[model samples]
Target: MTRKLTPKEAAQRYLREREPDVARATLYNHRSLLKQWWQWCESQDIEYVNDIDGFDLAYFRLDRQMEVGEVTLYNQMTVLRVFTRWLQSRGLVANGLADGMVVAQPDDASRNTKIDSITAQQILSYLEKYEYPSLRHVVFAFLWHTGMRLGALRAIDLKDFHPKEHYVELHHRPETGTPLKNKEYSEREVNLALWCCSILDDYIEGRRHDVTDNYDRTPLFTTEQGRVSHSNVRDHINQITRPCDYTRECPHDREITNCEATTRLHAARCPSSIAPHDLRRSSVTYLLDEGHRKELVADRVDLSVRTMEEHYDKRSEAEKRKLRRDEFGMDG
Candidate 1:
């Protein structure tokens, strides 16, 4: 005999059935989306599992069309579809609510817009001129040089870095709280450049001096007290860029309108306008410029070759200009 189950019960069962390897954060995200779906159904006076038809799902998609972007709507639809399918499998619902639902495709133009990559010289100038807490500066330097994703960087422990070996082992096991972006076997060891090794050594030493308790088990990047949240890193980037003068002028001192000053201003202004993911793109670009093969670079950085080509293949305006000048044999 088939038994009736409420939306909440079905959601709980679905979550319990999810892959054990899924990260806690990912599970929490799915739960949050399900809660939103439940709230919508409750407000509409609909018996969520029984009353939500394909038409209701369609209406919800249309309602959220403008409020949410295409990618987000797609993910939400995916989550709801999974929930409805679970209900159907358990004989709780007659039909899956999302079986016939359609999600809008992402606009090609919007998806194709290139992300700006920070140059090595620009990053160096920012480090030299900008004043940040030593730990934060080191964190920025490591990310710019190493190409580690923001999540992986935040989740890294003290033992992740090997100064003598000059390599970082990205452990993607369940216990480490590191989520693999794709398949389970994607985790691998990545070699660090000498420059990144030196910066990491300094940062680790500085962190030792800064923290007094549980230093052995603490995160690599942290605030004065201990490990910092991702939000803290975002806020720090905003704070650093708030006073930047992006018109190629030095806001601190107008007379200093040289290459060094302009570069610093650009770096300072970038974080507010750009996402942290751009740092990874910049690092990939650097690797490519240094004669690294695409496949090797992708494997080292835990990214696919297609992803490297699609996102990190951007050439800066400065690089383009230099190329043009060299081709034309023009004197500057």
Candidate 2:
């Protein structure tokens, strides 16, 4: 007889089966979102994964929407749908139930688009003019140029810097504490433009706080207490991306004095502020725009080709072909 899997068992199996194929961050998200669904199932007494109905999925989505922002809810729901389909494939859920679930996109979804290359450059120019040698300057410059993930950047230590070579080596050291999203697979050396290196060197000499991480590892980026936390990285990006911080103008027209985002804790609430991942996406798009080969870029950025094309690449068909030809010295 075929065994009926409980909701929790199905989620664990799904994540474990996908571990080899997906990034650790993506896998973690899959685990977190599906666990939420499984928890709901437990509370509702929907013991078996096979019994998850369209109504149940919809209800669970409602519960999630209440818990997160529209963009985040949409993302989590998207993941949940994939999990639901996986359960169906195992004969644990209703057929086509995942396809049957409809999660409406919020009207404000467009507001979440990643910063474009030009905008990123413009931000750099602004930072260079006013915030040179500051953490904002170094972080934005690195994120906009290097297409590496935030986790990889966060995991860097003072020892990883090669000033003469102008590169940073990313390593996977989960045993010592810094865990890259792709783990050992993400280990690589990323070259930095001289100007970028200059700013980073300046930050190291003048701005970086003298501190270490929980593992007693000296971090390239630090707080007074120690290595900057992940939330610190997020907040730092948010702090730098704020329109008021860079542009010195409030497009939102909110009273700057009264703006909650003016405070460090609320920095991410600013509509114009971007997440660190946006910078990574912008960097990938920028490299593609500059006629870099996708494969080469993928290798340098430690991303899969499919991930580069499907998520990071934003070029039009003609733009892509032109870049390809340009790289080969062939004119179309």
Top candidate when judged by lDDT against the true structure: 2
**Global CA lDDT of candidate 1, please?**
0.61
lDDT of 2: 0.81
Score each candidate by Cα lDDT.
0.61, 0.81
Residue 249: error of model 1 in Å? 12
- In angstroms, the error of model 2 at 51 is 20
Estimate TM-scores for all models.
0.59, 0.70
Residues 1-332, candidate 1: write the lDDT tens digits: 66655566667777888758576656766887787777676667775465557777777777665444454567678877777776777666666444666755655443322223443345455654553225556666667667777666665667777889988776554454445555366567777888778767866665434442243455667676666655566444423332243223333454443423234323322223333465677677777765567898888778888977877767667875776677679999
Clashes (backbone N, CA, C under 3 Å), per candidate, total 0, 1
